[model samples]
Target: MKRFLLHLLFWAVYLLQDSIMQFTWTMSALPGMPDGERIRLAIIATVIIAIPKAIFTYFVVYFVFPRALKYPALRWWLCGETLLVLTALILAHRCLNFYIVGPIIYHNIIRPTSILNLPYLLLTIMDLGFVSGYAFTFKLLRMQLSGKEREKNLLQEKLQTELKFLRNQTHPHFLFNTLNNIYALARKRSDKTAAMILKLSKLLRFMLYESGKGFICISEEIRIIDDYLELQKLRFNERLSIQFHRNIDQEGSLLAPLLLLPFVENAFKHGVSETRFNSFVHIDLQLQNEILQFIIANTTNEDRIQPEQIGLGNVRRQLELMYHDHSLKVTNAAQVFTVQLTLNLQSHAKI
Candidate 1:
């Protein structure tokens, strides 16, 4: 259907140009010639002029421009080719004008033989050169713009596909670890088992449904973090020391779902879990005006730090895709590992 519509539009424009050109010449000759004769000469000129115009356009654009002019090495060849083609086309146009259009116009349409004079022929050729040159330049510009647009669309599609795969990979790895934590509680039959189950349900609900969404409300993402922290608390209880702080300047901001989870998850998996005693995890969120800053730091076992730095790659890529110039830094010092991220939300805030 789209192709059909494009063809329809092309034919419509072509016919319109043909009619306008014929009408213009017919009106210009009306002062000296009868209406019927003037119209006849106009039609003849329009029809015959189309042939050389098409040939000039085709060779200059498709042949000369791409093969010769576009390459520096071929520029000299292009100069020679351009001169040869120009001379040939000008001579052809001159002959057609003198033998065909001029004779018909002189004998039938007008009394002046000046229409076939040298000056008249040169002026006519100059007019043809300007029109053909303008047409070629416009067509080249349109082609270049079209090519760039197609490249942009393809790049966007590839980025989306890569992001989706990363999201899919992240979900299963996170769920597997969380479910194991729940299983350990179920085996011992801890009193907090039911509460842990409720927390797990809410977190999983967000992950399976809301996290898959493109963007979620800022409140929803905060709640997910709150529930996830609570659920992880079940595993360490008295053994884990955790702190969470948040300051929100506005409540209506929106962000890419699941963007912040990997950093927090890394802190737990690497820093808190491996520490045998006196383990600590600190998470802070600060939103001022339009800037959001998140910091997560945890005590590391030092020995197992290298092994547990797993999910950061996927999170880093997601950040680049969603927030163009957002900042993220991770530091490992002695017994503590910290991750900090800052995002600008002024442009992305919802009502």
Candidate 2:
């Protein structure tokens, strides 16, 4: 339907421009188009020339345009083809003028029948050039816009694949840590081992199923965080001090699943596990007016202030891909490592 409309519009513009050009030339030659005779002649001439012009327009649009845009090296070949076609069209127009219109309507030969009539040939070529030029410009512009759209789609696909890979990377990093916690309990023959395993199962269900979804509610995400923290608390017992503060005004708000977990996991893995004495992990999450602010700080050994950039790096890259305008900052001051992240929840609402 759209192609039909575009073709219709192209022809309409071509015919209008051709008729105006013919009419102007006829009026200028006769000064007044005397008794409607010149007007009739101009109409006949416009109609006769329109056939070859239509042929050139479609030839370029459907055939030449795509090939030329795709293979620029073929442009010289296209130019040669254009010259041959233009010459043939000019010859055909001259034949129509001399054999049919001139002898029948005006009762006189207008020009020589041969293609070598330089002045008549140039005029015919110029008229065809002007009409075809319109189609040429239109088709070229359409091709450029089409190329841009295709490039955009390819880039989007690449980003999606990369994000999927990153998401996959996150899963194992988390599972490994959770499994270590479970292993520690089993090694100690602790009664909490089976219960932690059950928690791990639930966490797996959320990560495997819900996390794959485009977005999940803040409440669901918070539940996952609570589970994770609880599992960690079970492992560290009285040795780990955990302080969690949350002010969630919009529990219905949504964000990418497991998006905030890496930092939390990072703090637990390095802060509590590596430190020998008085280790603490502090987490604060606040959501108000469609903005979510997350802060996590943990006490680590001075040497381990900056942990290996694996899980946190993955999360940072994910944030960049997911949020256009977001803030993530990591600071290491003495033995305390801090992560600050602010996200526009309104952006997720759009998704």
Candidate 3:
């Protein structure tokens, strides 16, 4: 119903414009006729002439244009056919003017010397061409806009799929390492094994429920890291030295879910686990003015240092997909392995 109204509005506007153009010439041609009568004749003539114009416009825009696009090799033939149709429509316009409008407006059945007059035919062609051009241009603009919208939607879907895949990869990698620790403690018959399993259960609960979200509060992420640290502390006991420092202005700031845990997991797997004696892990996190800066350093034995692992690689890809304004740097020097990450969180912050 709305579409029908729009089309009605378009034709009404076209009739008004055509009536105004015809009124000027009509007033001069039928001088001595009353102004009211001249206006009536002009409007009637425009309405009658518009029939052929409307047909030609719709046929070319709806039929010819689509077929031309579908069959590229037949475009020239379509163009020639369109010209013939335009000529027929112009002739029909002349017949309506000669037989109908003349007798109604002039009260005399005056006939032209030849209905095939070249100049008159050309003038009719120009009038019809103007409206057809307008319709075709509108169609082209709508097609272009729709195409761009579809392309944008497809890109968004692709990015979302890739992010879900990367996020899934982190789950098993993290669980594998944590389960190894639990298995080791169980073999030793240590009492900490049950506590470690409980912590692991909590972490799993968060991953299963909360981690699937697009974003989470920074404080929730901090709580997860704290629980993970406690779990690790149970396994290492007094053998590992761990230190964590935080300076945050807004604990409620938003970040992509599970984005930070992989970094901490990588640090433990590669640095703390590979070293035998005198191992330490230090982590510092600062959030000021919607900018997050995270740094983690761990003591490492030179011979035991391994190559880039899956957790770090997955986090790097996630960062690339999620944040446009962020930086990550990794350094391994002497007996220290360090990771530094900075993120601009203003874009993702909740209002």
TM-score of each: 0.71, 0.86, 0.90
Per TM-score, the best of the predicted structures is 3
Candidates' lDDT values, in order? 0.75, 0.82, 0.87
Model 2 agreement with the true structure over 1-351: per-residue lDDT tens digits = 998898888777767666677667556445644746766776776777688877877787677877888999999999899778877887787787777666665455243556467888788788777777887888778878999999988888888888899989989988998898899899999999988998899999998889989889999989999999888888888988999899999899988899988889999886667788999999999999879999999988867456556898898888878887789888877788899999996664221
Best of the candidates, lDDT: 3
lDDT score, candidate 1? 0.75
> On residues 147-166, what C-alpha lDDT tens digit does candidate 1 reach at each position?
99899888888888888888
Q: How far is 246's C-alpha from truth in model 1 (Å)?
A: 0.9
Give the runs in model 1 whose Cα sits over 4 Å from its true position. Answer: 1-96, 99-130, 191-194, 302-308, 347-351
Write candidate 3's Cα lDDT for 101-169 as tens digits: 677655643334466778878888898999999889878887999999899888888888888888888
Instruction: Name every residue pair that clashes in candidate 2.
Output: none
TM-score of 3: 0.90
Ranking by lDDT: 3, 2, 1
- lDDT for 267 in candidate 2 is 92
